[model samples]
Target chain A: MDHIEHLEHTESPANMKKQIWNTFYVLLVLTVVDIALYFALLSSHSIYKNILFVFLGLVKAFYIVSVFMHMKFERKFLASIIILPMLFICFLIWLALTEAGYTFDSRLF
Target chain B: MSNTATLSTDNKQTWGGGKSPLSISYGKLMMWVFLLSDAFTFSSLLVAYGFVRFTFTTSLPNAIVKPFSHLSHTFTEEMQKAGLFVTERWPSPELVFNHFPFLHGIHLPLMFVSLMTFILIFSSVTMVLAVEAGHRMAKKEVEKYMLWTIIGGAAFLGCQAWEWTNLITEGASLQNNPFGPTAFAALFFIVTGFHGTHVLSGVILNIVIYINVINGTYEKRGHYEMVEKVGLYWHFVDLVWVFVFTFFYLI
Candidate 1:
């Protein structure tokens, strides 16, 4: 499809502007909450706090990718192209954590 | 014989490979592929950081070093209040990243980095505005928003330079630090430095595109796809910073 046709099919300038502002506000609020949690959980050594941070971070990341990067407007195949690699990334994280745990145990024993 | 062969091929209609199957231009698709690979690179670095941090926080110290040992003691009362104990030797992020601009020796925790984060996010907003303007074929608006985006990027790079200088002044290198483990400093520099390089290149790219926009290059082309492509890259940079800020600073 042509550019003007694509614009008409997806979003007008005003609608796109609204989405942008909405995302901006959402990201700002999330960051504010993160900062608050940082202070609230400062003295605690809980893994839950870390998990919360990661979850909030992922939320922000999703908003940016979908809205700001315009991935949401793209075709499903393109979106999948971007997302499929993330599974491999999760695998890498699991591997790293496992190795780290093994090393930590060996050092301790 | 030729008519029969043509009829067979026309009926088969092999997938029209020339056109974008995803309804996107090849340029945009290539950009997505590049970004996906870049994300993998960043994930590897961050995962490595996680691994090192886990190991450092779990292993017993050979000996409690001087300043960090003293530093750990200062947090003992608060840790006790929270029902936690200092069992390992990872340097506290709060103490490590407490410097603020023009407030030498004053501890501001994460104030400066938070400001930097806001700057980068604001830049991402401007980038989207630019892309939106491009979609509307508003060249002047696109120029304005692109200029703001570039300024925000440059400002972030300046903040990062100051942060790096502060860290170096505090004797942080890849090999060693007085705070806790050397890996802490090493990963901090490597990950953030790599991100800083991205910001630098983004600013430069924006400037180049800004010049072209002003010169009516995209205006002549009948479509502002270039601006949208660059916008994708800019947003990805901001997205990566979100993770970096969380894993490196807040956690």
Candidate 2:
């Protein structure tokens, strides 16, 4: 029993507090930018505007996952193991939207 | 038999049976796995929303309405008459979710949801702070931050309830939508409702953990890993909101 150690976890960095606050500011600014862009491109219903918004959302997600969730400090194998599978969502989006376009074309209205 | 004895000596290696390969505890690793699967569930819902939304024409440009202007009592009616809200077109989120609490008819767009986003983000920060405090074994700091996190979560839930009530009063529900196509209201309810349910559970979890902290359970156990585990869950909720805001509101 003495030889068996407690469950292991990665150590927090010394400046973790500062890093947390910095990430907060980054997330805050990115969200503000998202709102600003929403207004700035209000009249343009182009696909590019939607892409830009999604891109910014990904940026915010990165900060949250990397800093707030501590994925950046974790082992690369673990991070990749968790994140790589999410790429399939990109495939799903493309397939669904393409089918949706065909559905849109077929509609009589 | 000799091979078995020799192989046992390699237990400290990457494939070692006695050690975690990822250097993460079983509980934390499972938490990450759960979050990944949860992410997929949310992605599927949002993708369905995108497919349905894509089938409809993009929202018609709005030249008549401006932010902060007077919102007429018949605002939806006016939009319907103006053809801004029609069955063939997807409704712009700004027009649909424009109302704010206690400031009726002011024509605020995306203001309340933005505040909701801010609340969730702020609470996420507090949760991480609590985890940070936990690392230091600072019980008081952990308790304080956990309380703040709980308050933020509760406030966010309150805001969602108000928004839901507002939409319901305006005749938006799963089966009916006065704004535009029925699917618009349906997706809104489903996506945000799902995320709201997650937040509700998160707050409940936070409260439970808060009690355990108050009881000095972690102190007695000689570690605060539980805080870190629940913090992972709290942050995942916030992460889902980021995409929910993007697709449901912004895009």
Candidate 3:
């Protein structure tokens, strides 16, 4: 009986749909912006082109992670579990660059 | 280390049926746990791909022309075979994939991948609807939504198939292809092909679950956590496609 009540309570337009279409629309817009950025990177200056590519990539990834992956709805622990590890990953990348750059200065020179 | 032994008793309690065990169900929580682990798995894959891509050996053969010329060569020789060759070579990825549909000959590799990206994302949308229908005990809605998801999955797979054939026969391949660095063909096959296998499995699995849903199998369990659980798996597949799109195609 209680289970039925909870199921009934869970059923509603607000809960079931919950701005899914809105999210889809936003994702669509982001995709178009991504394509535009792709073109601008190709024809524009090279200095910020790489930066633009990485920046757009990160935004797209963030949207997928937070929305489709449901990290936004999860608990704080879940958020930490998801975001904190990426920090470690970033640290590793930094270490790799440091090591690679050392070879450039010492050996390539 | 602490995350190990996931099937242990503590997890058994929390993962399966811990939301007031008598009140809530175990199957749904298990799905959540399964998804959490899958999240890590996909992250590892995307990260590993990054590691390889950053360190990609630049000494590979003529990686770009190899695929295009391979197709152009086929087109020329098969003019008798093809009856009428366009005579123009298939543009490079830097050219072909980058262009808009009607605006042919434009260099838009990222745009093409974006379309594939939307296909998977739309499928994800349909899948969420399936889960919602399951929650409402709307059997017909569930079936309808599941059918949509199946169609979406099929469409994604079809796109992937065209991609693979274009790569192997008309474009770059292991032995063929005039461009790309070393290991490009091999890595391409391994990574994208593996993801294709996952989507295929998701399609089959969704079909089975849909069958069970309509046949009143999960109805005995008194909830559609089965659908939700599979929904998590399906979403994970879609999520992986997102990164694969960004890295393999866009980058």
lDDT per residue for candidate 3 within B131-225, as digits (tens), equals: 77777788889899999999999988987786676556545665544334434455567777878888999999999998998898877777777
Fnat values, one per model, are 0.68, 0.80, 0.18
Worst 10 residues of 2 chain B by lDDT: B1-10
Instruction: List pairs with backbone clashes in candidate 2.
Output: none
In order, what DockQ does each candidate have?
0.44, 0.63, 0.21
- List residue ranges in candidate 1 displaced over 4 A: A1-14, B1-18, B58-88
For residue B17, model 1's alpha carbon misses the true position, in angstroms, by 4.4
Better of 1 and 2 by DockQ: 2
lDDT tens digits, residue span A1-109, model 2: 5534644566778999999999999999999999999999998988899989999999999999999899988877889999999999999999999999999998845
True lDDT of residue A82, candidate 1: 87
Whose DockQ is higher: candidate 2's or candidate 3's? 2
Number of the predicted model whose DockQ against the real structure is largest: 2
lDDT measured at residue A104 in model 1 versus the true structure, 0 to 100:
85
Q: Write the per-residue lDDT of candidate 1 for residues B64-140, one digit (tens) a residue.
A: 22222333324434433432323346766666676777765455678888899999999999999998889888999
- CA shift at A86, candidate 3, in angstroms? 4.2
